[model samples]
Target: MYYPTIRGCIQALKNLEIWLDKAEQHAAAKGFDVGVLLTSRLAPEPSSIS
Candidate 1:
């Protein structure tokens, strides 16, 4: 379980890095700072009731 979770986290991190790279390229073309929208992951979620 831990191993799979760790691997998933690592993959997510790699994807974030790739996203940032693309964002940087886009920003450079328009001369602006690059960043990611982490709100989706940071926001609280509803608890399961069942």
Candidate 2:
């Protein structure tokens, strides 16, 4: 059980790296700052969560 969980976590980290690389490339191609994309949130603001 622990082995599978650890493996999944490793895979997730790998996937995140790949995603960040793609996002960086995309932002560069569109003439935007990579930092803007990196700092973006997928969910609504904290005040709206309530």
Q: List the candidate 1 regions with Cα displacement exceeding 4 Å.
A: 35-50
Model 2, residue 42: what's the lDDT?
95
Output the lDDT of residue 40, model 2: 83
The residue-by-residue lDDT of candidate 1 on 1-50, one tens digit each, is: 99999999999999999997887788789885554433235645556333
Give one digit per residue, the lDDT tens place, for model 2 in 1-50: 99999999999999999999999999999999999997889998999999
Best by TM-score: 2
User: Scored by CA lDDT, what does every candidate get?
Assistant: 0.74, 0.96
lDDT at 48 for candidate 2?
94
Q: Considering summed lDDT, which 10 consecutive residues are worst modelled in model 2?
A: 37-46
The best candidate by lDDT is 2
TM-score of each: 0.61, 0.75
